[model samples]
Target: MPDGTELIVTRSPPVNSNGVITLTNRHLPQLKWQESLLIARPVNQFRDFFPEVNNQNLTEIAIEIKETYNDYLKSARSLEDLKNRHPELREPYIEVTSAKSQRTIYLTRLDRFGTLESVFFSQDKQFPVDLQLVNNKIDREIPNSLLAVATLDLEGKSVEQPIGAIALSSVEEYNLKAGINM
Candidate 1:
């Protein structure tokens, strides 16, 4: 905001733990150390709160991001189609992103009514350097529909599970339904 670019800072869009970033509408809590905002729009990607840009670094980053997104989309589509034909797969799944070495994987499974599960993890040697095992297993159902993000700490090979979920009803059903006039 030092550049004097006014940010609406609305509460509807819901920010993530990384704080209110415009592009990632993850409605997680704002931790004390996170600067990522709780609101986002398409332009949030270009909002550089770091420092002045000199070369085409920003452009390059954006290009790589697009490529990554496309790769994920293609993979997800393929997985969905496979799941459709083989309905007995039970819980069909897809791993969204992975590092070059296959040491890390981001996973999501396809569900009925266009719903999908969420998964996230960060890897580091310092993350419980002695951690020999991780039991990343989840299987639960909420009778009342609600939105929730599960948080886990890979450090020390333990996790602090999420307590509750936010409400499902919202003003914005369709993307861009929240008028720009606001």
Candidate 2:
């Protein structure tokens, strides 16, 4: 995004065309899926591949996501019901992001070209521990919140104190999965 903000890029078919992943209605199994299916918050049209502007008012980022099909609602929060209604929206997308509570993140990366990715095993061969294995609804509330992040040298030791938690959401959940329920 030119505004130096983050975007929640969501796509219905979840196409990984070239290096870009999309959650748009452009490519669908059925054309009608564009109507009732692939419902999302719809990212602001200003966002681009990279940040080119220094936007200080970076708050309330409504990231696009694949939600349910409530005609009156902009983005549906029910996955199970959406599944029962639109069974054609298949594959790991609906399966991966489905959650009773909390949230499910399929994967995360740090490269601009998708040239390299983090791996759970050493054989995959990657750099930097950019992936955070957090599974809590409270911590996941903030759109682009930072958590206990630290860097290390080859020996793998904390190079600095992890950054403090930034809660953009004033609606604090002091007890929501407060005890590592994941």
Candidate 3:
């Protein structure tokens, strides 16, 4: 998936120190050289440091990271838009900013009641608020219990991941419950 950017993935082989594995290297030659050095140092000098390396988990880690970025981007955009609409209250609300291809996104949550309610995101802009575009993949990925709102700004040219989260609560006037302010 390297349209213009280069992507490199390399895996190292597991090393055997005596009857146990000490460390696994991602680069084959580097691991080999380390193994040789360990052998020369002593017969089983590294045997006591036997630790199993889960090489198979690397791909899973990358996939999870990619998903996280995607989710953050979507959330940020929506938050930015919400802020734009309520310009006066922008300072009161918490903000989480994330970046996509070129734009920066802000995610925030506003509490209205005792129960957790809805989440909001911002569209990158100044005047009118733009809601985040919904991606089918992201929609499917989220749990059914929660709803997501996002906004995207293609005109922006920043590339920093937004770092914030929102907790929502439903507003129920009929229910006599005072919210705990922290």
Candidate whose lDDT is highest: 1
What lDDT would each prediction earn against the true structure? 0.38, 0.34, 0.36
lDDT of 1 by residue, 34-106 (tens): 4775332464566677456666987789779878877887887787785664443334332222123333222
Model 3 RMSD in Å is 22.9
Error of 2 at 75 (Å): 28
Stretches > 4 Å off in candidate 2? 1-109, 112-143, 146-153, 160-182
The list of candidate 3 runs beyond 4 A from truth reads 1-55, 94-182
Cα lDDT of model 2 by residue, 57-88, tens digit? 44323222212233336324466565554443
TM-score order, best first, reads: 1, 3, 2
Provide the TM-score for each candidate, comma-separated.
Answer: 0.23, 0.17, 0.22
Worst ten in a row by lDDT for model 1: 173-182
Candidate RMSDs in Å, in order, are 23.5, 26.4, 22.9
- Tell me how far the alpha carbon of residue 166 in candidate 2 is from the true structure, in angstroms, after superposition: 14
Q: Please provide, for model 3 over 55-162, each residue's C-alpha lDDT reduced to its tens digit, 9 standing for 90 to 100.
A: 768657856976887788778778777655544336334332223332333223233211133222233344333323222232343222222233334459532222
The 10-residue segment with the lowest total lDDT in model 2: 106-115
